[model samples]
Target: MQKLFKSSHNAAGALLVALGLCQATPVIASETWHWHGFVAQGLMRSADSNFVNNDGAISAELTEFGLNSTWKLSNTVRLAGQLMYLDGGNRFQQGGRIDYLFLNWTAINDMDWQLDLYAGRYKNNHWLYSATRDVAITRPLIVLPQSVYFDAFRDIAVGSDGLAVTSTHNLNFGELELNWSLGATPIPKEQSQRVISTFINGKTEQDFVHQFSVFLRPAQSKSQWGISLLDSDFNYRRVANDIFADGDFTVQRVMANWRYSEQDWELSSEVFQERVSVYGFYAPGTERTQFGWGAYLLGSYNLSAQSTLYLSHDHFFANKDDKRGYLLPQQSGGLIPAYFGYQRDTALGLSHNIQPNLRLKMEYHWNTGTGRLGPNVVPDTVVNRSRHHELWAVQLMYWF
Candidate 1:
């Protein structure tokens, strides 16, 4: 049955591709509009672990389909968006969501300094290459570790709700970028349990949480170092009772990066940790705190002008069930201390530039899981969340 579904899905996709390729519309335009999109399709009937799928059964699923477009309202300002969809074969939703929707203003174009101001949604200026910060066409992976399975590293509400100002300067030493943002994210009154859900698939409550973050980078061209910090908090008002509470959600993270670059090669490493507090009482509706941390190293050697051999490895640890609130009189949510265990993985991959606009990567990953932390655990009918395990994957990626 599963095999039949997979086959049907692939056939539908191939048909779509054929139709899309046959599209040759006359370039009609009265205004300036530029568009571009790409798809990475394959015949991979592969399987993966699912904690919240129908009967915990494995299935082969198509992995990638992404689109992006931009409109130039002059060179200093543009409107852009990325539309992405993942067909996990009933494991996830069919409709996609926005990464960002914003109007960006470049106020400075000086040789020494530049200032960019934006209103509306935009990526948090946290990492050099955050999961959603950059364009999907240029990302190394079909998926990013920071966004899936975890929410802190690549925050959805971490975007700008109101306004943001970013400045960059070039100096004799290196280059510098300083960013500041103010925004809020909608607290799910309802979310699908197919992914990770706190309550059932319906709205338990509704509201918005405020967020803030900052990042610093010396220069990729100059051997230098940098740091990133984010502090976010949530206070929810009960919809039924109109009662207000503090620290319903809050997270703090700090990451440091160091790199050395020259004419031929580069080396870099990143390390960071997150402490999360979610309000809900295992002990009389109290809050708890969980810790998540990871590190990765990437190095590349120029095999030739058009080819490069690179290796990158990453590992992550998470302690879900910690709800020690950030507000005063901290109390542990104590629903078992930690309902989630941890995940760690390493990937060794290499990329070769077929041309300046195209590249391909081949890699293998070793993944392992951990055991849960608390008691009276209600296994959510998917994977037995109480076990520790391991798995692996081989990946082929391309981008332009």
Candidate 2:
């Protein structure tokens, strides 16, 4: 992994230079093509031994760079894509990776109705920040709400290789946007280990993962509200024999989002409910079910054109039915602690625009419980456990 990290750093340098040149190059055709890119570096540290990543100490692992481009072939056709390199501790993949590549076609383009069809690896558009979360400058915090944006499946939930159709209707009041996507993507081994090992006590390899989503947003004035239905189906194969079983895992998620932005202040909130089901894993006649719920409330104020301040509160439950985790001790044979059932986080964030193309960001998080921490990175044992902790992060980003 260290060697891979070194190689990724070298590649990132070269890509940065190339992206800078591309951004500087003028567009030959006025309305045909455009290119832009960004580079961000950050430092994060937590005051605990829990596994946010590698001992949870101060680390210089937060680095990302990307190049995005669009080619407008005609009035109704365009090719849009992004190539990105990301390494953000254990929350995401550590080395170079292709983020998204897609083609978009507009079948109906008019003032009242618009339809778009996309194929290839398309970005997830349901969540409030899913579309642009990869770019550091666009996010309001170092980490988005973990309840909705669980880090264990960060890569898995970001994009899918399939098809999507988006439709927009212009109304007298505001507008409505509807999107539907379906596809499958492969899960990396490391990600599988991080998420699966805690629940299943054996070595597992992903067989196939399927994803589907439907989102609808209605907007009026300066406020927009949306509801999304998302589904993920995962199957695993046993590599080495152990106590855990090889079977199917399915997750169904329903999320509601609302945002209001006007004048100098913005308020946003999202609530999600996730249902998890497992089949043929523990026993032949066994069926297990659990439901998890989470929500976040965020408000931001623009002090000036170049500076902004924001605060957010986020909370999550591993099992809403057993919020206290008393049943968890019995369920896991007393190996896991009760506090693993829930987590609550409060954050204060501020961002300052140093220049038109450069920005600085700082944030602090006061967190309770480790219910959602990556298990592989942070073992579920008392020796490495801390129920309460604080995290501080600083980032600098530049884009052109």
Candidate 3:
């Protein structure tokens, strides 16, 4: 009835329920219940902020609390839920969204094939790294690999309200998992109430996001590969330096990943090509076209039974029109801004198990890039070295 859609928190709650961890169900036979959660805290000392000047600030913070509890509905059915409370220098927000909610049905157990339906609000499965979109619980490091586009989760990454089906079939080698999903993006009520919301170029924000991908395990224990394709069309109205007016785009994403993981180390590389163009915008009179290519590499090492460390780098190049294709003109760095540029991020992480479930981690990060403003931004041009930034964080985490 109303366009006022659900919030990220609501979507997260549904995710928890769908995951079979937290659900509303009737009583059954002798019940088995278990609870799982994590508590983490950290202090970050930055040289750029308090360390430098106009650089950054020094503050000690943590994820605060991220916990979950799950119930078994049946051997095949389950009810699960998770709660998260967070405060930090990066996440810079309070409250947690549902991690997952829906029923996972296995069409055929004996075979290597299975089917799943995720209803309600859920995260977009655009890339292998999208699953770790959580603020403080999933990653011990302060920031994820930027080249993978994990930085734009939610803000730009598209999630939806629909069903996704995944099938895993075995071949001569390892196995192949193919997935397909169709859905729509979220629309806030305030935007709908407006005579014309600047967000989208249409009367309603209900378009389809279709995605497909395949994962291949070439080597049993050493090598693996993945190929992904995602296409989405949205009615958008963006304005910044000038005005995007209105337009719909068919965005195509091609991703390929190769990795070698063994008993003690993991080396992985990912390459992607994104081709997007406007079928048509709401704008009656305008012209636009955008395209780009990006790539990154990640490596990890198991130092000991208690310690592990890793590093990664990612970069992107685009044309003037491609730079303007972002949902928000301001976010895309103000349209036709610049062409040849990239983002470089370096991080070092160490996780040592103090005792059983208690662990300690220390991470250092150097991020340099240029957007326009806001949060860990680098710079668009070399002369603007003032925009270069540095970040540092140390944390303690425990799970039970």
Candidate topping lDDT: 2
What range of 10 consecutive residues in model 2 has the weakest lDDT sum?
A: 1-10
lDDT for each residue of candidate 2 in 281-354, tens digit (9 for 90 to 100): 66555578899999999999999999999899999988899888688679778877777888899999999999
Residue-level lDDT tens digits of model 3 in 136-164: 43553555665555432333353555666
Q: Which of 1 and 2 is ahead in lDDT?
A: 2
lDDT of 3: 0.55
Give the 10-residue window scoring lowest on summed lDDT in candidate 3: 372-381
Rank order (by TM-score, best first): 2, 3, 1
Segments in model 1 whose C-alpha atoms lie over 4 Å from true places: 1-32, 42-48, 51-60, 74-76, 88-93, 131-136, 143-160, 186-199, 202-221, 234-247, 262-265, 281-283, 300-310, 319-340, 350-361, 371-400
Against the true structure, whose TM-score is highest? 2
Please say which candidate is ahead in lDDT: 1 or 3. Answer: 3
Each prediction's whole-model lDDT (CA) = 0.47, 0.73, 0.55
Score residue 51 of candidate 2 by CA lDDT.
47
TM-score-best of 1 and 3? 3
